[model samples]
Target: MTKAKVGIIFGGKSAEHEVSLQSAKNIVDAIDKDKYDVVLLGIDKDGKWHLNDQSSYLLNEENPKLIQLNKTNKGVAIVPGEVTDQLVNLSGSEALGQLDVVFPILHGTLGEDGSIQGMLRLANLPFVGTGVLGSAVSMDKDIAKRLLKEAGISVAKSVTLTKNKRDQINYEEVKTKLGLPMFIKPANQGSSVGVSKVRNEQEFNAGINDAFLYDHKLLIEETVIGREVECAVLGNENPIASLPGEILPQTDFYSYESKYIDEKGADLAIPADLTDELTKKVQEAAVEVFQSLNCEGLARVDFFLKDDGELVVNEVNTLPGFTRISMYPKLWDISGISYPELINKLIELAIERHQRDLQLKNAVYED
Candidate 1:
């Protein structure tokens, strides 16, 4: 059996570019070498796509893919749906090889924010993770909450804001509505970049401005003091949920530093302690949110268990961290999936979804 060609797209024009690199490394290392004729597609901070070592421009200054990965360098991405048999170059000339699928490992913005998904959809390629709609909703905290709330899932009360709405943005309104000492995070970001805890009005304005730098929208979540829990879900239409894990942030909150930089920023408690009933409820909630977003490939559903012992949905991560030691994989690891097995499963799931999508009757004239 010929190994399927997979373009592992990584590093992007986002603040989480470094994190994306780590994720790409993990996937590149894990995918079954026997079954995958891997293609390393590196999209640097400038968003220029490169295959192999052709363009050293825009490569991670400290970390280079060429230094680590030895694979065929396929230059440029042929945007999906163009009627050309050849994959167009970044300059829109020539064709790259036919790809079985794409595995975009971007974090935040263009990667997780649905921009890349849109391209994959247009190209008619089966890529990993949620589709554009699901990606968009899940990436934005504000939108995710609205949809989750509508789906009968308990979500923290949040007030959204943008730069244009600054004047109209009532600090007092948020204070009265969601209260103070709440979380202020960029709506469409991950890795906790530009996220802060606003304890007062002065800090609230500063936090909003800080968040707006990363994204136009900001979410002020009413702090739900509880056990930080996470569950990994994979597959489409009857996806399975892995056992939940508890995140003990080694900081005031799960900030960017705690998530990656700081060595002692957090600890994980796998198969979190819970009653059988509570466990079932958490799993059900995770799957429910997955369905609500119409997610396909995978997601890491985060939750907050209130001091009252009630579970509250935090947000769904369409593309959670996968740095080998990340929670999504670790949680599933303790649940029985190995790192390589997890990657293989994701790839298999992507192929399954693509075939399923292709199977949908296209013509209105069904005999």
Candidate 2:
């Protein structure tokens, strides 16, 4: 049997670029060589795509803080409206090869906020993770919370602020609304980039400035007092949820440094200690959030499990981290799926979704 050619696209112009490289490394190492052929597609900070050599693609592979894309590979471009010749070398304009599927291990901004997914759709490529609509909605925290609230799901109380309205943002007004020790973050970023826990007027003012550096929009959320828990959802149409996991953060909150840079940033409690009934509730709520957000293939649904036994949906990560210590794969690993097996299942799901999408009529009149 012919092995499927899996194109693993990683690194981006997002703040989480290094994190993406880390994820791609894990997937490339764990993916089954017998069942699939891996292609390394690395995107630089300038948003240029390259065909990286599998052996020497990543730099500083051992250190998460210093790890980066080698950026010495031959540049490539996607060929839209053609599946047979999906990618071509930029220098010679020659077809590189065909890809059976794409695993976009990219996070934040253009990568995770539906830009790459839209491009992939135009190129008629089958990529793992959520579709465009799902990716767009899930990446924006304010939009996601509004939708979840409308769908009868509990979410954090937040006030959305844009860069244009910076002058009108009164620290006192925001404080009164969200209270002290609120969370401020960029609306469309992941890996906790540009996120801050502001407790006073000075911090609030500084946080607003910092968050807007990453995105035009930001969210000022009321800090919920609860234990942080997460659930990983898999599949399409009828998705299943893995057992919940807990995050015991050593820092003030789950900061970017703690997540990717610091080795002892947080402790992950797999199969979080919860009553069977509560576990079922978390799973049910997770699936509900997944369906409500139009997510397919996979997502990590985070929640603040209140001491009163209430589960408030935090946000949905459409392209959650797949690093060795990342919660998404770790949760599933504890739920019976190994790292390699998880990659295989994701590719299978991507192909399945692509076939299903092809069935829909694209035009009223046949060409």
The best candidate in terms of lDDT = 2
Candidate 1 residues 92-121, lDDT tens each?
Answer: 466766888888988899998789988887
Candidate 1 Cα misplacement greater than 4 A, ranges: 53-75, 82-94, 363-367
Return the top candidate by TM-score: 2
Candidate 2 worst ten-residue window by lDDT:
78-87
TM-score of the candidate numbered 1?
Answer: 0.90
Q: Please write out the lDDT profile of model 2 over residues 1-367, one tens digit for every residue.
A: 8999999999999999999999999999999999999999999999898899999999999899789899865889889888588889998899988999999999998887899999999999999999999999999998898899899999988899999999998888888888989999999998889998998888989999999999999999999999899999999898999999999999889988887888699988999999999899999999999999999999999999999999998889989998878999999999999999999999999999999999999999999
Backbone clashes in candidate 2 total 0
- What lDDT does model 2 reach? 0.92
The pairs that clash in candidate 2 are none
With a 3 Å backbone cut-off (N, CA, C), the pairs that clash in candidate 1 are: 80-122, 80-123, 81-123, 87-95, 87-96, 250-265
